[model samples]
Target: MNVQPPEAYATYKTYSAQLLAWDSSFSAFMSLKSHALTALQIRGAALLKIHHTTATIMGRCVPDPTDPRSIVTAANDPLIFSQSTNDFQTVVSLSQSLVAAAEQDIQRGNGRLAGGLTFSTDMGVVAPLYYVCIKCTDVPLREQAIELLGRCPRREGMWDSVLGVRMIREFWGMEEVHRQLRQGMVKLVLEDDGRWEWSWRDLHNGGEGGGVGYGVKEMLESQI
Candidate 1:
């Protein structure tokens, strides 16, 4: 059903230049994934795309001793797209390297990053509870964290993005963190001018950030 994957793989093998040309398109596609887009994922994809593109274009324009033209040539080959070829194997190795780097970057940022943590396994449903809290008592970090939450929740890999409702209840007892997060949400709403989607816009704009009618004002009242 998905012919794109094979085509992408082939593009990686022979005409690396062709693949390089598609870099912007590929990035746009990746961005549409939303919350699933991680800093590391973005970085790795950029690095991979640029490396391949540069190699292809340079190979045509000028020769370089440091570049691995063989790998680039193999990755951009057209035959590999029709059938799995040795070029795919080379691409696979490169992919593995990128994945490793991405993982390392995530760990460095998340501190105690657990690939994917789950609580219950009933019906194969794992609780969604992704978070992006910073250990700072300043406006910048807090504000940035709020913005991060607003954007990140729309992504794919995040638990909050996927299973926030189920996970929120689990953290009900942690008032301090919960309150801070609530404030962050409020900031998101105010910053967005309350004109976004009250239910999910992360702003007062009436997206998802408004809560179920009670609103941030009512939420604070009830909490206190």
Candidate 2:
């Protein structure tokens, strides 16, 4: 339960460049790496409903003196469970470790460019943004995520605004919320394409983690 200095963010772009320049191919070595990546993904999703705090997760959870390897309930609050003896810290550390490993990919090198947020170079790239925002209470990490994204006009998409409206409608199943979504909210930001727009960062990233677009539907439909 002692605090240690956090590991420095490691994305050695230079070393990655060197590795790629080598003439001898490492395709045989890469097969194991590929398998590991797939395994990690399988393992990650195995944790049920990580978006909700009370959900049970599958990972290196807290060590209990009573039951060292037994399944223990981890509270939903990542900030609370992040204490040294809890599961949140272990999960966060493992996530950062993945980022460190992906930093070694010289080809494309997008993982390194993703600012220690992603492992593979794809849609999952934005996962680190969701992680630090939820797990760690570090302001710098959140800033780093936004900075790495850079500035873009209309950064958040129409999907989010509609989802927000849907959320309001779902909650309490109130007629007022339905009226607002139909009249106030939707009319406030209708574009030429007849779609509502949003400019907020999506904390619950359904697109990357969830199977469908933004996973808002899934989250809503979930028993949580």
On TM-score, the candidate that comes out on top is 2
Structural similarity to truth (TM-score) of each candidate: 0.21, 0.24
**Per-model C-alpha RMSD:** 20.9, 19.3
* Tens digits of per-residue lDDT for model 2, 138-180: 5455444333333211113221222333343354244334444
User: What TM-score does model 1 achieve against the real structure?
Assistant: 0.21
Please provide, for model 1 over 116-155, each residue's C-alpha lDDT reduced to its tens digit, 9 standing for 90 to 100: 2222222111111122122122333333334333332233
What's model 1's lDDT at 198? Answer: 19
Model 1 ranges with Cα > 4 A deviation: 1-17, 62-224
Task: Estimate candidate 1's alpha-carbon lDDT, on a 0 to 1 scale.
Answer: 0.38
Among residues 3 or more apart in sequence or in different chains, the pairs in candidate 2 whose N, CA or C atoms overlap within 3 Å are 53-76, 206-214
